[model samples]
Each structure stands twice: as structure tokens, then as C-alpha cells.
Target: MWFSRGLGSLNGVITIDGLVKRRGKTEILSGVGFQALPGRVTGFLGPNGAGKSSTLRILLGLDRAQQGTALVNGVPFVSLADPVRTVGAVLDGSGAHRSRTGRAHLRWVARSAGLPLSRIDEVLELVGLADAGSKRVGRYSLGMGRRLALATALLGDPPVLVLDEPLNGLDPEGIRFIRTFLRERAESGRTVLLSSHLMGELAETVDDVVVIDRGRIVAQGTLAEVTGAHRSLEEAFFALVSR
Candidate 1:
């Protein structure tokens, strides 16, 4: 995909084109193209092996694509001079040290970024972890861990947020909180790209969507444009991907 730096006045514009990835002889993605505009919660939807994780990894610069490009904020994520303030992500938080306190973990990240210590508590509270801020990560439930990961992502107050399965292990309340939070973030002129396999959730939470299947874009447009409310998102998704 090619972007001309003419993405209007959007604070962040993510462009991907011909994104190809191969693991050995098996092709993971082929010619995927899409654009995520700022100020909207763009849902990234796909089947179990539709290369969503691969795409997110490539976008975050954690993995390289064999072909094409993924640009964040009009530049490749890897080429960004300062990524912390440009983009924030929470792909997986299982890597965090289980024995460490949530506050300590956030403090470490802040220290690495040369950011002030107070920002840690602010983000922790922002993600609804204020009461459990001092608890060790191991003691926290999966929902709490997800909240902690969200806190980490919000630490930099980045303009773009890329989250994978953010509602993975959350309860109804947690999911509701995240839905509201993401909506508010977009209202604040930030960009949010959320990947999920849950079509029902996506239908309720997203303003726009990019649906992928077999590593290819099957549909891209506003929720109404992609899934006529008469046809549920799941119905539309299955019809598109199954083809």
C-alpha cells in the first residue's frame, strides 16, 4: 500500500500495503492493505489464523515483513525517532515479571523512558488499578493483569494505541470499562486500532473496521458500510472470509 502524506488533519494515519509474511514455506499474509484514521476506534477483525497477530507484530516493529510496509504516523514504526510518545501498545503482558509489584513494573518502564515517576501512578489509576497499584502481578487476576497492561500502554500518553485482544480475559465490567475508555480516547483525537476475533464485541465497540482473512483484506469501511445492521458483523465476516 502507498500513502501520500495527504491524510488530511488526522493526528495519526496507519497505512499498510502488500504486507506479506512467510514462515518457512507457509505464507502467513498476502497483499494486505488498509488504512487506520485517527479519532476513531478501528477494529481489526479476522479468524483464528488470519495473521492478525503477525500484522500487529509487524506494525509494532517487533517483526519484519517479507514484503510491503506498515507505517505509523506517516512513518515506519521502526524509523520513528521517539516511539514512546508516538505509539503505545499492549500485545501481550505475560512477559512482565510475575513477582514484581504493578507499581514497580510501571516505575521501571518510566525510568527507562526518562519519564517522571508520578506518571506511573497516574496511568495505573487511569486504568482502574489505583486500589491494587501496590499488589504483585502474580496475585492479580487476569482482568487485573489486563488492566495493568493497559496502564503500561497509557503511560506515555501516545497518540496511537495498538491493542491485541484487549478484552481477552476481562469480566463484563472490565470489558465495559475498556469500551468506554477506547471511545473516549478516540474522542480526544487519538488513534485506536484494536484487534479481536469477537465479532459481537467489535460490532458494539468499533466505528470503522478492517476485516482480514487468510492474511488478506476482505473488507474495510465504517461499521455500517461493512455490516448492514440487518446482517450482523459475524454474518458479514463469515460470508466475506469464507469466500
Candidate 2:
């Protein structure tokens, strides 16, 4: 049940165009647009309530936009023929039942996606959860739960990964692991799009950067371009979004 490292011919492009989302009279996103190309890690950076999660939600089809499109490859996520095999997403934690063991939770997901049960072990080990697979999810710590969520995302070995605040609960070691892993994925020609407020960590991981604030995109480009004339990405981010 070994999955290939990369989908050689598969295109893993994420196109977000003119995304506009409104809740009652307040707009959550305003004409947001960006492209996450394959073979690169794209960091979606913003402050809290800056529309980062909202944009990702629309991209993953968990939420709708009022006047824009979020497409993976050539079509929307909801229209993908084999979604589980096309895009792996990590959002809202593990989404696992409290009573289920980590392995059991992965087993259910594998079954639902028609993936081989053997993949469960592979992903568990990949996420460094091999020893904790038998632990009940409810008893796991926040970092452990995040790892399980990552394991679940890798189950299908999708070419595109969309994650929101992926570094939320990770420790230093876990952060290092994820940063290296994501870089490897991008080097292997996969698409990695992640939203996080940890600018220092993201500066090391992302090849491209997109900055959003107050539901609008204020800056976007290669890491160097976005960090132009700034001491670091953190400085650049604050300079861009500070109002």
C-alpha cells in the first residue's frame, strides 16, 4: 500500500479569484485572488479575523463565496472526480470522535475513501504517531491531535494539500518536522498551501507568500518579493497589515 511520492502528470494548482463573502452586512472577504502553483509552498498570512480561514474554507468547499471562485487544478473542489485522491486538507483539528483510537479513526477514513488499510500504518508513522496510534483521540494532547489530523490528510497521498493554521498546536520538534516535510512535498512537485500566523516558521517553509487583511489582499509574491526591504517576514507582515 505504498503511495507514490508525487503525482507526476497531475496538475496541483489552486486558483482563488475575486472571492467575496458576506455575513449579513459585514464582508468577510473582498475580491480575494491568488494562485498557488505546484512545486511550491504558498503561505497565506494574516492576523486573526483577517479572512485567512474564511478564504481557505471556501477553497476546500466547506464554505461558499458570494462572488468568486476557488478552484483546485481546473475545477472547484466539490467538482473533483476523486477529491480524496486529489486534495488532502487539514482544518478544524482531527475531526475524530473522542472515543476512537487514533488508528481506528484513520481506519474509518481509509475505508470511506476506499484507501488500503495498510496506509493507516504508513501515515501514522509518517506523522510520528506510530507509538500513539492505539491511544484514544480524546486523551491525546493538542499537538498529538494535530499530528493525527496530518496523518489523516496524508492517507490519500493527494498532490495538493490545503491547511489552515497548521502550526497551531505543534511543538518546536513538531514544527521542524512539518516545515521539512512540507518543503519536501513542494520539492517533489506537489502543491502546499497553508495559512499560519507564525511568520518566522513560515518564512523558512514557504516559497511564495500572500498577505490578506480586512478581507482584502494587500500583498502577494515570492517570499523575497513580499519581504522586500524588510528585515524579516514578520516585519514585512506587520508593515503590510498594520493599519
Candidate 3:
């Protein structure tokens, strides 16, 4: 288990406490909290309109929280001087320019991060995009685009990775490949947090889970602990959120 920081002993794990989010008068998330540990897959789950994406945006510092805190290594993501080296994230793949080759897009990102060009090919191969690296990103399929986004995430090989709906629009083979890839990353002593609407997929890929509903975390623990002998994770999940 990863220990907390000195003195305060606040867990080095990714943590959010009393997290509240709002847009004008609309509240999106309220009292959201969870911890993501290194070397494990923490599945972030919620139904549509349940604030999963909002929470991920806050974690990436793309959206600031109106209340509470989102921290990695006990520091807010925006406060970090070098976010790329500390955390790797793939919030959306549409950020890439349509006319750019996959390799060129990655090259620019790597250059900005002061990462070596070799790391670009390394991540491309890891994401099974080695053959398509020279192809224009707009010509690629949705799954291929997602893979490119993932490759961008791995460019830094950071200790923490946060992916949102990573398996969406993926083929069966793509889904399986990404599941294995994420598991391997966590096994190598990295933190892996994935948000997915597919609870069944989360069952197969995650070690722990955090369930959100109406912008709140309703359940969190090991898959087994949360399931508690239930026939499936879906069953346990529904039981919690439906409660």
C-alpha cells in the first residue's frame, strides 16, 4: 500500500474530498470522493448525467472545481509545475488536427514535453498503431483514434494515468487490447484510473471501483468487497446506486 505524505499522512493516492461542482446555478457533482491507488485499476463508474466526465475534467485541470479538491500525490493537478511528467491523461481524442499524421501529432506533443522522439514510436507500438503512425489521423477509425490518444498519454510514461471512456467506440479486439494494456500499466507500479459506462467491462478489467450517481460517490472498494458474493459487479452496482 502507498503511504500518505509526511506529518499529515494524507494518502499519496489520488483523492478527492467533499468535491462539489457547479455551472452557474446548476450543480453537477456534490460530495464526490474516492481514492485511486498505484498498481491497481480503479474503475470510475456512473450512468449518463452522473458527473463522471466532470470529475475527470477536474482531475485533468481542464475544469476547475468550485468546491473541494482533486489531488495527485497530495497536490492539486493545476498547481503542479510539470503535469505531463507527473500524470498522463486522455480526456478526448478530438484535440488532434485532422490533417496531421499520427506521428506528426505525437512528435509535436513529445517536443513540447521535452520527451524524446523514440518515446513516440515506443508508445505507438505499445498501442498497436505502429503501422498507422504515418497515416493521417482523420483517416483512422474511431478505435484507431483512441489508440493514438492513448499513445499520447503514454508518451511520458508517468506514474499516474487517468482515462475517460477509454473503451468507447472500440472493436471487441480493441477493447480487449486496451483492457490488457491498462492492467499491465497498473501492474508496473503505476496508478490507473478509468471511467467507463460499461460496468461489465469494468468487472473484467478493474481491481477496485468507485460508483457515482447524480454527482456523488455512492460506493467504493475492491470489486469483491463491493460485490459481496453477488453474482456480478453489475448486480452490486445497481444495488448501491438504486438504493
Q: 1-243 in candidate 2: lDDT tens per residue?
A: 112434333378899999999999999999999999988999999999999999999999999998999998768899988888889999967779989999999998899889999999999999999999999999999999999999988999998899999999889998999899999999988899999877987898999999999999999999999999999999999999966
TM-score of each: 0.93, 0.95, 0.92
In model 2, the clashing pairs are none
RMSD, one per candidate, in order: 3.6, 2.6, 2.8
**Off by more than 4 A, model 3:** 1-12
Q: If both were scored by TM-score, which would come out higher, candidate 1 or candidate 2? A: 2
lDDT of 1 by residue, 100-208 (tens): 9999999888887778899998998798889988889999999889888888888878888999989899899999999999999888878899999999986888999
- In model 1, the worst 10-residue window by lDDT is 1-10
Q: Per-residue lDDT of 163-238 in model 3, one digit per residue for the tens?
A: 9999898999999998988989888778899998899887989999999988988888998988887899998878
Please report, in order, the local distance difference test score of every candidate based on alpha carbons.
0.86, 0.91, 0.85
Scored against the true structure, residue 205 in model 3 reaches a CA lDDT of: 90
Output the number of the lDDT-best candidate. 2
Give the clashing residue pairs of candidate 1, or none: 1-17
In the predicted model 3, the residue pairs found to clash are none
lDDT of 1: 0.86
